[model samples]
Target: NGKEIPYDPSALRKIREHPCYSENASHKFGRMHLAVAPDCNIQCNYCIRDFDCVNENRPGVCSSVLSPEEAIVLVREVMSKDSYVKVIGSDIFPISHPSGTIVKSKDSYIKVIGIAGPGDPLANDVTFETLRMLKEEFPVPLKCLSTNGLMLPEYIDLLDEYGVSNITVTCNAIDPAIGEKIYSYVEWEGEKLHGRKAAERLLAQQMKGIEMAVEHKMAVKINTVLIPGINDHHVVDVAKKMGEMGVYTFNIIPVIPLYKFADIIPPTLSDKKAMHDACAPFVRQMRHCERCRADAIGKLGKDVQEEIYRNRGSL
Candidate 1:
């Protein structure tokens, strides 16, 4: 082990309360997501990365973009009214693109920190800065992000430097061949291309990322999107590899029908369960996934519906 990356103490406390906190929660952590960047570096066949806007109803699906200064104000205002607020990535850093989602806040209890955006945080330097700035100015106890691991080697050091212990890297395919089948094309450096080359490139990046996280002593987790016939078989390989790489947990999320990808079939109950079974031999699987909205507030589970009626707050 390199240096022991300390876990977020406060995060551990609120994790139970977050709707999406546990792997067995019927709801997601009632955190707020925001899109600091409207653009993205890479395009996945099944994603409309720019859909994170607050004005939208799809909680946990997307958050609206805002400037750094604007984000600060938004955080302050949200804090003034609500007791909990989380900052999720809606193309906020990790893309390594010039565009950034920077939020500087001094608030001590902003709740769980998250950064699952439309883009890959490893690809963007600004993403690291945003986190670093938060670590310095904010009393953020739980710092989290959802990344594609495109630039893991480049940013793993930064992750450790910023003391980020909780993280989720979306690994759709462990095999490049399967990856090519799932991703149509990627937009890199103003160039549009697809096929095996793209898949290979992405896989290589993510694999290395897993290694670095372990070496840095950071708790690692894997998020695999289970596309029906695409990478189902290879998902097992994904689990084994992540487990060997020291991944602490794994979340096998079924494909959500949305945007242009809406036409794509959603994962059947059996399919989702099968994927969970596949990963069961390796890491722990999140069992009670409610598939809550991107900006969902309050608790998870069907029993909590009545609570949704009780609470009318913005995420």
Candidate 2:
């Protein structure tokens, strides 16, 4: 009788429907990410927003930016053409029976709409407006967003009011010393912070945000980039802290060697496995992350902007 019970049935349904949360749902449901937020508040060493490389498939790469109205139109078009069509012909052409009947085939539909950034979603106002509009117009889809966690504490109440149940916060290190090595600077409350000062402020906000998200009864996921010689040694500590705060899942992703981190090698598969094993006792691990692009669409590994382009033809 001491076991914790979920108060919201809708939350359970959302978890089940989200491919990122359930492995079985990955094959059944699809997701669409709109690249509405194109500005970032923090400067991560591994991130390079200036150049676009086709070989890379991680975040901060988007084909183009869309206004809120353009994004809404795109979502509507995607929802409309997500299925296949079949036409049947009748020989008699009677008054009661139509000459032909058009039937649509069942196909994977976009059940989740997320803004995963060309930059941090919370850094841009368009992200909030876009989500608010989606909540008002199309309430069936589950709403989610990923952030750097700098602005998360201030935005949690608004996110809850907008019906965003899923939130992901990227926490690289619990220790500010290690965090300083990863992040170059952060824009906080109109002030620019650098080095250890930035790292300390970021960690404090991230911890506060995770706690507040749990307090609001929102499903929270922690995304940690495993950078060797950096935050790699500290992931388990981050996991332990998150587990105590009631985080839903821990996603330990290998850092994409880019920009300032180009010299740092990516983690080996064995290293990833070891990290997962170490954290397994404390929190559930998400092993199927695709490290999707900002404008990623369709299923996990099968995400393609071409599908969205095809839908845009209708608009």
lDDT of 2: 0.78
Q: Best-fitting candidate, measured by lDDT?
A: 2
In candidate 2, how many Å is residue 222 off?
0.7
Candidate 2 C-alpha RMSD relative to the actual structure: 6.7
Where does candidate 2 stray beyond 4 Å? 1-11, 51-61, 81-104, 310-315
lDDT for model 1 comes to 0.57
Highest-TM-score candidate? 2
The all-Cα superposition gives candidate 1 an RMSD in Å to the true structure of 9.8
Model 2 — TM-score against the truth?
A: 0.86
Candidate 1, which segments miss by more than 4 Å at Cα? 1-30, 49-62, 79-110, 122-126, 187-193, 257-263, 290-315
State the lDDT of candidate 1 residue by residue for 1-315, as single tens digits: 799987762245434433344542223333443334354455566666545411112224344444545544444454453322322342111112244443432223234455555345555455665676667765454565556776666777777777676666778888788888767776555667689888887788788888887677666667777776667778888888888777767777777656545777878888888778878998766666554433333334322212322343342
